[model samples]
Target: MIAWRAGAAYPPAGPFVPVAGGRLATLQAGPERNARGTVVLIHGASANAADPMEGVGRLLAARGFRVIAFDRPGHGWSDRLGAATPAAQADRIAEALGSLDPGPVIVLGHSWGGAAALALALDHPERVSGLVLVAPVALPFPQRVALPWYWRLAAQPPVAWLLSRTLGPPLALYYLRGASAQAFRPQPPSEGYLERARVPLAVRPGALLSNVEDLIGLPAALERQSPRYGSLSVPVLIVSGDADPLVRIEAQAEPLAKRIPGARLLRLPGLGHMVPWVAGDRLAEAVADFLPEAASTR
Candidate 1:
């Protein structure tokens, strides 16, 4: 099989690990022995293991933590495995972690992946010791924002199948650069982000379809899952950019911090949705500081 980087000249960052329906691609870093703790990185929509790996995985690894960034279910090199919701995706990730036999871990999830992290912490509590949510979309927005017509259309399975084979790839390729720019609006993307993050892999027909499915399905999933946030027992740190246009801080992070008891919210001024890329060092520092407290609970 082709590597997770798809057509990129370089090799895949890590190996594929077996899970339920299929395998997941994972990029691992740091020493295996005497590590601070395992930190799992989950990327948002239209991203792969490389996104968070490049964002903060290496930095955490360098700090004496074992870090693993997974291609969430269908996103990167991972098999789709019928993970249609964040909860389902979390189960799949939990299975992978079980096989790897890593004890309870600290999970850092960005954007939509934040929802997945919340699911992991709630449904598979034993798998996650703590959470670092960056620009997360864990709760339903305060106001209803209508989705674009194309997004709604793409959400349908029949249309999605046809479009994935016919129009999706080209359309995704056409919009990829603009979308990345918009996602990082008010803050330029870190240099060489596309290549380093293997972003082009996301535009492949299947991955693009999965992205639309994940995005369109998110709101309802959050509505169903949000009410359960109060039960999470792990230490949670929410880092968000107040100026984020995609996932608003007031609507998502601020409310989430309050919903989860003892959760801490750190709002960064003048920043945007791409917090992991633009402010990875700060995030690493936050993780380093929060980990001790997280470990204390265990």
Candidate 2:
């Protein structure tokens, strides 16, 4: 195991470590000594790492795993904004893992972050001991063409630009609310949660452009790499909500599970895409079950 002393300047609660290629802004809480293993939590598009995984991190830490949550590039404090392709993001995570002492480390990702984690596992399998995918958007599902003709027309170039520039923030907020509503039935998000999320939505200047680029580039990336899932040697646990509107279970989770050898799948009957937020403790418990004996025992 590799041990690097924490710098005095680093936060006792959340430490910021500089990786060789890029910095990984991480928040960790757990036993100072005899930590079982590290669990790196990755978040989704338009949202930073802290927003989605913080609660889950706290829960996991309580269960004895050293949980580290970091902001993905272009989304949070590590704002080296440009094209944040899945492959590039994965490479950065690989570098961050290098800084830590070798142990059984689990990579847990939500939504787009799940795709990023998958990329990491594909590119650097040795760095990950296991994977927990929460409502992962794994494959490119069929696009909905039933919307109004004008909506489709607006999705094209300059018109889309005009609409995006004019109402992007509001539209983003609307979509966020819509996602929350569709994913979490019976109990909608509180005003405070949405309001707090608005801060990140409002402050992120490059979010719209980055999201568009991510959508444009992701399909090709998945097409290129989908066939290689069978080659992954690491243990994988896939969790998804049947009610998730954004990611189709058939197109994403089921197919990917079939391709990957020994991959376990857990489908929540009425749960939505926000599984990590809505069912975090339950998800963590499920993940804890899959962890290797060396890591889980500690």
Candidate 3:
């Protein structure tokens, strides 16, 4: 894997923990002195845990809850484990949380990370207090991603090593800018978002492969998970942008809200996929309202 300089540019928000045969990077905050509950932030694909959740984590931390953000496997400083399976990724996170012992947690997952959040909630409902899935890719739509020829070859382990050695770096570098633009669509990134988020690192060979697997393998994962959504009894807040190009709200979010009984839906009129950057404060407020009252001493 061609590790990006940004991996060394700055460390993940917190230390790394050994879990699931790899190091999982975690960023944590909140005053444990009188914490109500834990809020676990799971970031989307191509972006690490820190960049996307930075603003919102501070907001939630100030609300008297412990906030923990994780670099999803193979993204940021976290070692690449079996990230292709959202279930495995969820298990890795659960193992990490077990080490922390924060008690039941409110999970906030964005985009691809939403799938992980859902899997965690599904498999371990006792551990998850509530869910705030933003622009989540939880439902399998009819049309799935059209994997690039390079991605097809990259997903294969035999040629993947060779492909990563030769073409992965350059391709990731080239596509990242356009990818960011698409993610923030109908509006550009907020000031310093590109650099602050370490956008270049998505080009790193490992991260790119993981990203491709996430895109290519998502439909089946969603298909497998969607049927069980009704069984999840946790309070859920489904937030999405009406103008989001990446995960269509009409196709994914609306139906998802219906699947989870009494799941609350919040729609931003024209925001794009990057809700934290586009409307962090508003989203935070909405989340605070949706969450079950956080006890003063959890």
* Per-prediction CA RMSD (Å): 2.1, 7.2, 2.4
> What C-alpha lDDT, on a 0 to 100 scale, does residue 263 get in candidate 3?
87
User: Per-residue alpha-carbon lDDT of model 1 for 1-298, expressed as tens digits?
Assistant: 1223355654456888898668998999998899989999999988999999898889999999999999998887788998979999999999999988889999999998999999999999988889999999898753237368778877899999888877777777778788889989899878898888988888777788888888888888988999999999999999999899998899889989999999999999999999888988999999999998889777
Model 1 pairs whose backbones collide: none
Candidate with best lDDT: 1
Model 1's alpha-carbon lDDT is 0.88
The candidate maximizing TM-score is 1
Q: Which stretches of candidate 2 lie over 4 Å from their true place?
A: 1-13, 20-22, 81-83, 142-167, 170-179, 182-187, 190-192, 195-203, 293-298
Q: Model 2, 135-246: lDDT tens per residue? A: 7766654334323455555556676666556666556655766765654553465445544333234223344555555655566677676778788888889998887776
Query: Over all chains combined, what TM-score does candidate 2 have?
Result: 0.79
Query: What TM-score does each of the candidates earn?
Result: 0.95, 0.79, 0.92
What candidate 1 gets wrong by more than 4 Å, as runs, is 1-11, 142-146
lDDT by residue for model 3 (86-192), tens? 78789899989888887888899998889999999999776788889999989876532545565666678767766665787877676767777887898896777
Sort all candidates by lDDT, best to worst: 1, 3, 2
Clashing residue pairs in candidate 3 are: none
* lDDT minimum window of 10 residues, candidate 1: 1-10
Full-model lDDT for every candidate: 0.88, 0.67, 0.80
